[model samples]
Every structure is written in structure tokens, then in C-alpha cells.
Target: MTTIHNGVSPRAHAVQAAAALAASMGIGRFVYTPILPLMHTQSGLSASLGATLATANYVGYLIGALAGILIPGVVRSAAVMRTSLVVLIATLALMPTTHDGSIWFALRLVAGIASALVFMIAVSALHAHLRGQSQFLAGWGFGGVGLGIALSGVLVFVVRFIGSWGTAWLASASLAVVCAVAAWGLTPEPRPIITPDAPGTPSSHRWFTALVISYFLEGIGYIIAGTFLVAAIDLAALQWVGSGAWIVVGLAAFPSCALWAWLSLRWSRPTLLLVALLIQAVGIALPAVIGGVGPALISAFLFGVTFLGIGSIALAIGAHLQFPRAVALLTAGYSVGQILGPLVVTPLLRDGYRDALLLGAAVVLGAAVAAAVLRFRFPSDLDADPRTATSTEEVVFDVR
Candidate 1:
């Protein structure tokens, strides 16, 4: 029962926790992208099964996000953080070992739940400590997911170079191990703020509904581009360019998250979010609709730049809604979005990407319109509570 509501702050400790959480949640995501084709060729997995595993992971994340809404949490809850990280680390290490598609799916579901707990609780911690710091404190915590994305990409590249999926799993697990140690000693100070509810608070919840729809749609739109961006490149007969394109997306994402967060300081969160969503929608549809490496690479770049801002913008908007339950509601809506994205797109995988990109484009445009409504109607820091919806959906995705 250490109270940090009005005492010595734990800003540094909060940041550390957030970084660790981000790293754990980012497990194997980068590796999953570029190496998926290789995995299918070498590991003898089917495309459908691969899709199932992804579905399971996102399903797990969705469940975890819903649980976060009801879970009683306090900032600097070391026990909660440690337990969540342990679950995430174990899943990362064990995920590659499960050959049975069903079992792998279950593990991913559990891992997603664990990750949601760690992510939300850590944000609770940062938001608590940063009550006195500028608005950007939560933004930095949110940005940790971007850094984690970068680190995960590097780990994947090294593992791909070494030629063992096991090595990548091991390396990521080791990183989690180190993070656990660092985060364990952090001050266990609880922030004690109440997050938003799922069905409660009419005005806030209505906007929450719109935001959730946008987020879920972003999930659909982004994942199609994410899952097949690499394959699409290879299909177009530009393997090297496609690979290079992903690297560029990852590169831009690392800094663009910070840049977007900074932009939130100067402009409306909803405006920036709308622009980013539209840019990504166009990027997503470009590969299928356009020809050659030039459009492909450009699509990748725009995808990278616009995508890095989404979670930040969404979470920042949640902060603006100002209802008591805004953060949790925001998270739940985002999780719902992530779950629906893959499910909706999974069936259309065989229809070529025309359906996929068009669906995605439609959804992203929907998100943009919702963002507009949000900016104009509710444009203030009403729900400035601290929390991380970064993992509420895919924070940073490079080409799949």
C-alpha cells in the first residue's frame, strides 16, 4: 500500500516498467512478419494454420484487454507487473515450440492476456506519477512500444541471419529476463485512479463506441497490409525491394511515434489521427492497386509514417475525453478493434488482396471520419488518465 498520489514520484521507475512491458508484448512480431514465408517453406505450416496462430494471439489480446477493464489495479503494482511479464516471457519462449496448431493458439491467447495486464497496469503507474509532469509523460510511456518494436526487429534480423527460430525466441526471452530484473525493484507505488467503464458513462461511452469502431477497423485495414505487404512485394517479383521496404517502415516508425506525440503538443489529437489514418489507408491499398517497386516502396514508407502515430493518437484522444473511465474504455475499444481486424480479413485472404485492401481502406476511412467527429465534438483533455492502448491494437507494423 505505498501511495504515490501526493509524494515522491517514480517517473524513472514508471518508464522502466513501460519499456519492459512493451518489449514483452512485442515478442516475435517482427520475426513473424518477414520470416513467415520462410517458416511456411521450411517448417511445413499451412497458410491457414499460420493465420490461425495469428488469430489466436489477437484473440488472446482481445480477451486480455477486456479483463483489464474490470481488473482492480494500482500504479507501481510490482506483483501485477511481474506476474504479467512472466506470463509474456514464458509465452514468447514457448510459442515456437508448440507444433500443434490448437495448442499454439491457446498459448498465444494466454500471452495476449498477460501482455494486456502488464501494458495497462504499467500505464496506470506512469499516469499516476506523471500527474504533475507535463502531458507528454504518458506519451513517452506509449512511445516505449515503438522502441520495443525497433528492438524486436533487430532481434528478428539477427535470428534470421543465424537461421533458427529457436534462437530468436531465446534471445527475446533473455531480453525479457533482463527487463524483469530491472522492473522488479521499481517503487511499488499505486496511483489509485479509477479508469473508465465499458458500458457506463453515456457521453464518454458513446464516443468510446465510435473510437472502438475506428480502432477495430484500423485493425482490419492495417493487418491486411501488414500480413501480406511482404508477400505482395514478392508476388510482384521484387523480393529485395520488399525486404528493404519493411526495414524502411521500421526505421521510420521508431522516430515517427515520438514525432507524432510531439505533434499532439501543437495540434488536435483527432486531426493528426485522421490524417495518419487516411495516409495509411492509401498506403495499404497502394501495393495491390499500383504496380512496380516505386509505388510499392512508397506505399511502405507512407504506411510506416502514418501507422506509428495511430496508437498514440487514439490513446491521446482517450485522454482528452475526460470521463473517469476513459482510459479503460479506450483500451477495450481498441482491443475489440484488434480482434475483429484479423477475423474479418481472414476469410478474404484467398480473394487476392483486392478485397483485403478495399476492406482496409474502407475501415480506415471510417476511422478518419470518427476521428473528425471526436475532434470537433469533444476536443479537450477530459480523460487525461494514464494508460497504454498502444498494444490495445498493433502499435507499429512493418511489411508482413
Candidate 2:
């Protein structure tokens, strides 16, 4: 009765497959994050150019996310993933040759698009097939982000021996190729039959819109901490701590997601999300204003603890809102916020990136406000089971 493509049993296969895809996707996010310290000295990168590169990638992500949401074909095919991976590999390889700002920006933009497509398709597949699975399993699958972050960080450190960023790209490309192949078999194609909603289906659009706004604000706020925290730490002249701190963040992230999601069963999901935003805001702002190594590590730990489970929580919010298209809209809005994060922060780097942190804090605080608004505006749905992520439930939140 069960098939490997559809989730054979135990959900182990789905988790494995999801982890592989998440690792591949997350490897791209942090590849350049750790190297911010070395960017200007060894790589001839300027603050503005660095910002441009980040913007390009995020913009591409926005475009690609839209494409995936609008065009169903983009989400269904193994070939789409293969092509996206190849693009990711090639774009990363081109990073060293980016002497001209225009070319570099354009290439990164392309890479972002490819990354968005790959990420969307892979996560959608996992959500579709891994229904009824424990949120812990899903959290574990997403923990691949930690693994990817660790591997990429180590690779960057290794590249320091060769003193070539290009080699780092090549090595990462090789590893991604391996993971891609392993993941290929887990990828899904559409089945002929489609299920329709039962009578008196819930309408959760208001909640969905609320979640989208919160997710978008989170995208902006989190990137400030995630992308430039390295630079901020480096600016404080604690380069070693800064570099190692990311490893801590990655390590903490592995288990925190599942733990937090599990906690949601007893607590309010919106409250948990607000707490996460507060924690992240503190992390971002602490390093922005503080100078001590103790502060830096504390910030990293808090960020790591809260960063995971965001997308899942947003998706859960959508489910509660009863919105038919919440996932697509949320992903799109979040991608846009992601694209804007680096762009808005570039000018502020001249001010020691403090301005960026302040902005990020503002954005995250905005998510908290949005969450509060959702709670106050939609009180009736809070008591209901909004997390319809069961195997028996449809994978509608997988629109990303």
C-alpha cells in the first residue's frame, strides 16, 4: 500500500530525504556568511558590493519563489532540482571572478533564483509526503541546516589553507552533487488523483495574511543577524570568536527546532513565535551595541535557538487561518523581505552595521506586533487545532 516516493513507513525515509535537501539549501545561505571577515582583505570585496551580492541572491530568491508558486511544473519535477543544483554550483564557482560589480550582482541574482526554486520544491515535497509525521521529525529534517552550516563553515576554514575561495566553491559543489544524487530518488512526481476539501471547510485567510506579514518581517529581521552578525563580530575585533560563534549557532539549531515545536503542543504557537522574535531581536541588538566576547556568544546562542522552525510555524499559522493560498503568499512575501534585508543594510555598514542591527530589531519587533495582532484579531481560532500537518491532512501549506 505504501511507496518509497510517497513515504514508505516510519517516516524515516522522508526525514532523510528532507534532511538532504535542507542541507543542500542551507549550505548556500551560510557559505558567504562566515567569510565576511575575509571579504574585503582577501577577496577585494567592499561593503556596498557585498551588500549588492546579498541583494542579488535574495532578489533571485524572490523571483524564483514566485515562479515556483505560480507555476506548478516548477515544483513537481526532478529535472527542475537537477537544473537548480547545477546553477547553484556554477554561480558559486563564479564568485572569485566577480571583479566587476555588475557581473557579480547578476550572477548572484541567478544563484538566488536557483536556490529559491530548489528550496521551495524540496520543502514542498517533504511536507507533502511527510504528513502525519511528528513535528520533531520535521524539525529534525530541518536541522540539516545546522549540518550544512557546519560543513560549509569547515570548508571555508579549510579554504584558508589554500587561500582560494574558488576552491571552496568547487569542493562545496562536489558535495552538493553527491547529496543531489542521493536526494533524486526521494523526489516526487504528481499522482493522478486529487482530493477535495470536505463539507464546511474552515476559512483561515485572515490568519494566513497575518502569518505572511510576520514571516516577511522575520525574513528582514533574521537576515540582519544571520548575514551580518559575522561582520559585526569581526568589526569588534573578535574574529576567532565570531567565526566559532557561528558553529555554536549551527550546533544549537539542530535540536532546538524539534524541542520548540514539541513545546508548541502545550503552549500557544503565536506566543512561542513572539518569544522567538524577542530572542532573535535581543541577539541582533546585543552584539550591535556590546563589545565583549561573552555578549557575542550569548547573541549567537539565542539566535541559533530561535532561528529554526520559523517556516513551519508560519505554515502552521496559515493552516489555522484556513487560507487556501497562505503558503504561496507567505513564501513570496518572505522572499521579498529576504531580498530587502541585505539591500537595506548595505548603506548602514558604513555606520559599523549597528544601523542594520537596529533595523533588524525593528523588523523582528514588527513580527511580534503582527503576531499580537493575529492573536487579538483571531481569538476564536486559537483554541482550535491549527497545526493540520498530519499525514491524514492535505499538504496544502507546502505551496512554497
Candidate 3:
């Protein structure tokens, strides 16, 4: 019989969780970035339409996240995860059948909802299953998103050489299905033990508020870059350059969480978050300013390396602060920011994606400043014993 903490192997659980993230969050949610340019060339998809579709997906993600928080039993069940995986696969498979823009929007919106359920469910289950395991194991599990990104990027790239836009979506669906099967048995983790907070006592309100603001800002900045980096590179450089850069982003992101987790042992989480945001700001700007393959690859590397690490550290910090419903709160804010990312920059696309990229960099810089302020305000936040934090508090995987 299963208990709150069980005898599952951390490595096995981490690998399975990573596979789930790669399928649902990476391929299901994000395979669109690399494929958007293809759609533009072959299917007459305009930049404005693409941005609208992205916003639709973000809206769905917000709705799905809210569902997870409100319908706790459903989101926590393995059946939901399996159902989400099937829905994600079906969305990808169905994308090629529709030529209408509204239909595409509807497909992506459903995909977004499915992706969020798979991501949150997997993370919640894995957190419980991996309890008492090395924190590094958890970090490795989060790297699955990066792995999925890389795999999907490569699939799109290869299909571009031999196939059309529809083929790319189909190929991505096939890959996602395979990953879903691999992760099938890892779910339905034992229900976590809950410890109620003392009534009338809130912990670290100032620091928590600052962290959420910074994370929300980071979500906006990161999505602009994440959603459009490939298209931006395609406009400036060779077609292959954009896809190659995306692959680099995936490769760099795969190990980043573990690296940041290791760094957390020595540095404060806020300090690491600030530094990562700063690096990401520069990274997001490089493709716009440099416009060459070398600079584009560097930009991808920097973006990948920091984005996941920043997320891991920020969630960990939330736990440290003992913030109630911290993950749910932060995720909702972040999803809202993502919805705003494309809509905020729609007017700028008439000029070119360079202005949008620069805007992303500026927002990230603002996020860095937020992190710095938080660091200064609560220098001792990291000194709290993380071991005392409830497992339920240790929620979220950097699924993007």
C-alpha cells in the first residue's frame, strides 16, 4: 500500500516525470514556435494571427491552472493526467485538419488546457513521489521540459527539409504520444500529507509579494522570447538558423535546473534569481542586436540556461517563505503575464520582431530589479530551513 512517502526510486520517478513534461508542456504547448514560420510560408499565416493564437493558448492555460487549484481531486488524480496526455496528442494531430484561423485558435486553446493539466498533475505527483530524495533529483525531472523542446525542435527541423507545415504537427504529435506512454505508470502518486498553517499568521508578506511580482514579470518577458525567438531568427537569418537556435535552447535548458539547485546550496535563491534574470535580459536582446547565427545561438543558450533555473529557484523561495497557495498564486499571475506578452507587442510586429525582442529584454531587466529589491528587503529569507517546508508547498515545474 502507498503512503505519503513511499519507497519509489528517485531516479525512476524523475525520469518519468521529465518524460511527462517533455510531452505535455514542451511538445504539446510549445512545438508551435518552430512550426509558426513554416505556417507563415506555406499556410499564409500572418504575424498578427500567430500572436492572437498564442494569446488564446495563454488564456486557456490560465483557465486550466485555475481549474487545478479549484478542483483539487481531479488535478491530483492519475486519470486526469492520462486524459490530458490523450487530449494533448489529439490537439497536435488535429491541427493539420483545420485551415480556419478560429479553428486553429480553438485547437491551441484546448492544447494549452491539456498541457497545463499534464504539467501541474505531473509536478504535484512527482513532488510527493520524490519526497526524501535528493533535491537534485527534482531538478533533473524539471529538465524534461527542455528535453522535450529540443526533441520537438529537431523533429520540426527535419520535417521542414522533407515535409510541409502539417507534417511537422503530425510528427510532433507522434513524438508526444511516445513520451506519454513512457510516463504512463509514474502518476497517481500517494496523496500528500497536509499540515495546516497557524491561523491569523502570515509569513514574509513583503518578500512573497515581491517574488510573485518578479515571477509574473519574468513570465511576460520569457514568453515573448520563447514564443517568437524562432520566428524572429527566421526573419533575420537563414531559415535553418531559427530551428537550430531552438535546439540549442533546449539542450542548454535540460541541465540548468540541476545546476541552479547546486548553486542554491551556496547562494541565496533571490540572488540567483536576480542574476539569472539579468543574464536572460541580455540573452533575449542578443538576437535582435546581433542578428547573426553565432549571436543567435548564444542568445538561445543564455535564455535556456537561465529561464528554467530562475523558475526552480523562485518556486523554492516561495516554499521557504511559507506562503499559502504560493504555487497556484504565482502560476496564475505568470499565466496572465503570458497572455499579455503577445497582445502587448502586437502593434510592434508591424515594425519587425526586433522591437518586440528589445521589449522582452527590458521587461526581463525590470524583473531583475524586482528580484534585487526582494533580495535587499529580505536578506535572510534563504536562511530558513527548507526541510521544515511541507511537500505540498514544493510545487511547480518550469513548464514552458
What are the per-model numbers of colliding residue pairs?
A: 7, 5, 0
The digit string of per-residue lDDT tens for model 2 on 10-52 reads 3655555554554456566566677666766677888888877
Tens digits of per-residue lDDT for model 1, 59-113: 7767766665544542236786678778778877886686677777777777777
lDDT score at residue 286, model 2, on the 0-100 scale: 87
TM-score, predicted candidate 2 vs. hidden true structure:
0.87
Candidates by lDDT, descending order: 3, 2, 1
lDDT of 2 at 207: 59
Full-model lDDT for every candidate: 0.62, 0.69, 0.84
Off by over 4 Å in 3: 1-8, 198-203, 377-394, 397-400
List where candidate 1 sits over 4 angstroms from the true fold: 1-11, 28-31, 74-76, 188-209, 226-231, 234-247, 291-300, 322-324, 351-355, 375-400
**Per-residue lDDT for 1-400 in model 3, tens only?**
2233345566777888899999988799889999999999999998999999999888888888888777767556888899889998998999999899999999999999999888887887776676566777778898899999999999999999999999999999999989999999876555555565412124478788888999999999999999999999999899899999999999999999889988877977788899999999999999999878899999999998998888878877776666777766777788899999999998999867999999999999998988887777564634444444243453465321
When summed lDDT is taken over every stretch of 10 residues in candidate 3, the lowest stretch is 391-400
Better of 2 and 3 by lDDT: 3
| Structure candidate 3, residue pairs in collision | none
* Model 1 poorest 10 in a row by lDDT: 391-400
Question: RMSD for each model, in Å, please?
Answer: 5.5, 3.7, 2.8
Best by TM-score: 3
Model 2, CA-based lDDT: 0.69
Instruction: List where candidate 2 sits over 4 angstroms from the true fold.
Output: 1-12, 192-209, 377-400
